[model samples]
Target: MILFRRRTLLLSFFVAMLVFSMYLMMSGNYPKVIYRDSGVPDAEKVSTEDSIDSTDIESVISTNGSGRDFFVEYRLERDRLRSQEADYLREIINNPNASQESKDKAQKDLIALAEKVEKEMNVENLIKAKGFEDAVIILSGDSANVIVRSEGLSTKEVAQITDIVTRTTGLSMDKITIVERSN
Candidate 1:
């Protein structure tokens, strides 16, 4: 009878301990704002899984790369700057003081640059839809640099990326470089 009582007491204590532990785990320093919507439609929100930060990105690059990180944000900022520059150039061309030759040149450059940037953004989104945790594509003069978060990559994965980028940009494989991001 004594042994039975002791066993029951120990079991009760363990159950209490488990509940306490779970309570502690459930409580954290972060606020839970994921489900609350403040009037904007879901489609308009960038939804880079705004909850994730950089360190989280480095440690756990999930299969989905839509999560916002340094690279994604940087790409966004770069795109905004490019758009602004084009707008500024348009203003310059519209200025009464500008020469006709200058306006013509600006118009041509803007058309070419706009097309390239738009293509790059489209390719980036296509790659992201493939389930990469985070992807960054930088298009320089002749080649493109792509960085993706993943523990590792197989030849097939690289080939998949090449296929996507090629289809979007019409760029040959030689000019496309696939790079895996490291901590």
Candidate 2:
């Protein structure tokens, strides 16, 4: 009877151990499954390049928008600056309290500011060096009651160039006019 009881105890212990091991494996605590779908096929399977359609390639290209947004954003910013400049010039001219010396000083300051802005906007070197053939540079200055012509550049390009030149020249961005040229 003692021998039989000992054998039964040993068998029960083995069964419990087997159940625990199985539970661990099924519960994902143990790495039971060795293989998974890696998305890439094995050497025996056909490749993805051969299966993809031409339309998929076209779709990818179409999804990438062009530089139109950059151009528009650049234009709007330029126009805002131009308006501000006009308003500033008007204020200076209309101020009756300003003495002759003060007016002369203001005029000189405006010219110097415009020239500095123009020099900064001069991205001819950068545009040419960067190989941006589509780009055009335009310049404007603070000479009141005089029409200044840019080398056939669009008003937008002019403003953009002005902005760039001002930034490069460390002048106030608001004081400069940048415009874009339309081809």
Candidate with maximal TM-score: 1
- Runs off by more than 4 Å, candidate 2: 1-68, 124-130, 133-183
- Candidate 2 Cα lDDT to native: 0.41
Best by lDDT: 1
lDDT of 2 at 27: 75
Which lDDT tens digits does candidate 1 get at residues 1-183? 853564365446445645853674477421233323353434433333412223332333352244434553455445445656666666866778999888767766655655666676677768778877667676665677778778898888899889988888778999998989743
TM-score of each: 0.58, 0.30
- lDDT (Cα atoms) of all candidates against the true structure: 0.61, 0.41
Q: Compose the digit string of candidate 2's lDDT tens values, residues 71-101.
A: 2233233334443553464467458987767
